[model samples]
Target: MKTESQLNIIFVPYLSPGHLNPMIDTARLFARHGVSVTIITTPANASTFQKAIDTDMNCGYNIRTQLVPFPTAQLGLPDGAENLKDGTSPEMLGKISYGMSMLKDPIELLFHDLQPDCLVTDLLYPWTVESAAKLGIPRLYYFSSSYFASCARHFIHEHKPHERLVSDTQKFSIPGLPHDIEMTTLQLEQWVRTKDEITDFMNAAYESESRSYGSLYNSFHELERDYEHLYKSTKGIKCWSVGPASSWANKSNEEKANRGHKEELAQEPQWLNWLNSKQNESVLYVNFGSLTRLSHAQIVEIAHGLENSGHSFIWVVRKKDENENGDRFLQEFEQRIKESNKGCIIWNWAPQLQILEHPATGGIVTHCGWNSILESVCAGLPMVTWPMFAEQFYNEKLLVDVLKIGVSVGAKENKFWASEGVDAVVGREKVSKAVVELMGKEESSEMRMRVRKLGDASKKSIDEGGTSYNNLMHLLDELKSLKASKALEKTNLKI
Candidate 1:
């Protein structure tokens, strides 16, 4: 191999936690392998993952953060409110999307100075493909989702089956996918249907992905063999499948050193202690994820539903949704649960990984975010899917219809916090039944076994000589080969 300096790669992430956190872990993985990595973010969003990045810094990794200001004032958003979580309506969320485009200049300037060997950016930043071209470096699209969802979207995009349907409710076969998947027009996320700015931006994003060097997925071949191959054949873009990357990077070495580290370990959340006392596979864990906001009525139904199911549970309730009706219902329920020791409620945040790994935790009632799906699968727990909005509905379909590892609460409406009011309320009866069936039935045991096999595969993929590990090694070797050729060409030009 021709002599060359170490390769440097820059990772640029979107503002949401779900998108940003996984990319951070991917960056850390690169650093661990002796690549210099820089993560691009707005100062406000940087704080979200900086602590984890700092941990690697302390551990002697070459990961660093580079900041580009999020255009808060230009978008008329309040100072420091740059992320999707801070937006209360679609209008403001739109502005946040607009702000991302304005970041192109600052990012391009940084690229000139760093002259990285490659650029890896989230799918939203369509401009990065050109940014990489300007510096004569390669760019790769980073999809912070499953290959199943991306493949589904690609088929829908090409076929336009939703366009010819009689009504939004009519179900049509997703054309050109390996699996026989059926989906209704309404289940498609809002962005796919419209002719608006967001739609235009995404169209451009897909175009950029098609033109880029390749795409990177946070998934592995063992988990989605057919879809991964289908994605490559359909898109014609080279891909690298190195994942369960989130858990692989974030898994605590300290805990691994003591695999038997009990729930009562020093500084463990008190919730874990409560979980440890419960019988094996006897508790239901519920959370709507970080960005979703439920109406007071919806919240009340879920509260009563969990109570009616008569199963032990721990629910993570958002502090933002509490009201007189919901607060009153939860308070009354909490007292009864305390007396009976049937449940626990955490008002804002819960330590998700620890709880999911606990032996007492049985099933999850989830928002079906891709990150959450991977985490749950890695824990070998089946889910009760309640998809709120965005691509989550598609994710739910993957779980309930394709994988058969989940039961649906049948999300009747796609409500985002960016909307004015609730679209539909899944009543207590439906919620209760789904929870009961998931936790108390033989089918649930079968699903748990199915998911546990996937979980084992997930763990193996990142281990030495596994599919994901080998893919990662091949990727690095190719990049090194490319670097050697570039260095030799420069030397010849000088001569």
Candidate 2:
């Protein structure tokens, strides 16, 4: 058997923050367990988490990142516009995607050159499955979301339940899932509704998972035990659930504060002090992951809802062009909230993990993105789920229905960030009502107790002799064994 030091693995994380951050944390966790780890990404993407990697290196972990030049000039994009968050327009978004596609050849060449024992890559890069096979190494597919979402999607794809629906608004139950989950065709991605370029691309990625060595989830057993079992038994694949990965990797407050992006609008102390003044479980933390873009009307509704709810909140507002009519209104609203000290508006990035961990932060108004849901669960906070797109609607089902740890904001339709229009907006009444019920109702305490138990389980699952810890050890052993068997096959061919 190869020692942990001898086993080398390369991680290829997608350029977006939600995908990139957790994969980097998982890579660092592998390094801590004595594996030699290398992450390959474009320079702009590397900058997001290089500080965390440098800290691990300084602590004597064998982890480092290799930078690939981004095709900014070729794609006609700005120098640092390599991440999904950087795509401000449809044209820019296409360019960033094309830029990512342009890297496949060079990245595959690196795979051949590095000769690592295994490759762990994001679900977006289906091409890496073939590259890993060519190198005679196992490729582990890193799924940044939950098992429940995966299982829900699987059943939806398998049964074509949405195909039988008469209209996009009609609800259909996904067949063969562990729980009775209902979704409308509108909640599915645009690709799922019709076969297009993206449908083909996503299909290839999901097919690649079945062809890979196995899959890894950023979830624990207790969180989705039934769905995990259903996923494995139905798919008939080897998998591991080693998660709450962010919590496992970023233990210190300093690490949590600086987890993802390097730039921050205000220093950590500024927000920390704001939270300190609030009572325990008094403030609502509102952030729609990195990708969701709200229209001006939606923003106004949110502002009014929070104000009407009569609750304290800290909302992270993404920096965008202020040419819209709502900009002046937002400025006036910000001024009013600032004077009242009822709300705090942070422009651009906020230290999400640290804010979630703060005692004074009571609940979250989330986009139902898996990472945000996991982080909120770790903080033992119930959610006001407002899923925008992707697998988020599926995740919301897990939170609101299966887990009973969240209250839905009555969002009925699903729309991508760029395509969000007046048709998709949830009015102020729903928003205010959900927030009030989540933070003030008697049932809120029961939800908090249930979520706090899950939070405790998340911590225990990553500790020594825990499920996730053992799963990591077993995965390492399996990788070593696979490497050894490949070596023997080559020796036999020579003989």
Best by lDDT: 2
Scanning candidate 1 in windows of ten residues, the lowest lDDT window is: 255-264
For model 1 the local lDDT of residue 274 reads 82
Give per-residue CA lDDT, model 1, range 1-495, as digits (tens).
111477788999888878886787788888888788898889888776666777788988888999998889877999878778777666888898778778888988999988899999999888889888888878989998878888888878888999998988888998887668887877787788766876887789778889898888888887788889888888888899888876788788343222211232346656767888899999999998888887777877888899899999999987767668777877887888878888998876666777788899998999989888988998889999999877888788788877889999977555565233455788899999999889985758889889999999999999989898888788877777887788889999999
lDDT by residue for model 2 over 309-350, one digit each (tens)? 999999999868344677888899999998999999888788
Those runs of model 1 whose alpha carbons end farther than 4 Å from true positions after fitting are 1-4, 73-79, 253-268, 418-423
- What value does the lDDT take at residue 188 in candidate 1? 81
Q: Give the TM-scores of the predictions, in the order they appear.
A: 0.93, 0.97
- Residue pairs in clash, model 2: none
Clashes of each: 0, 0
Error of 2 at 378 (Å): 0.4
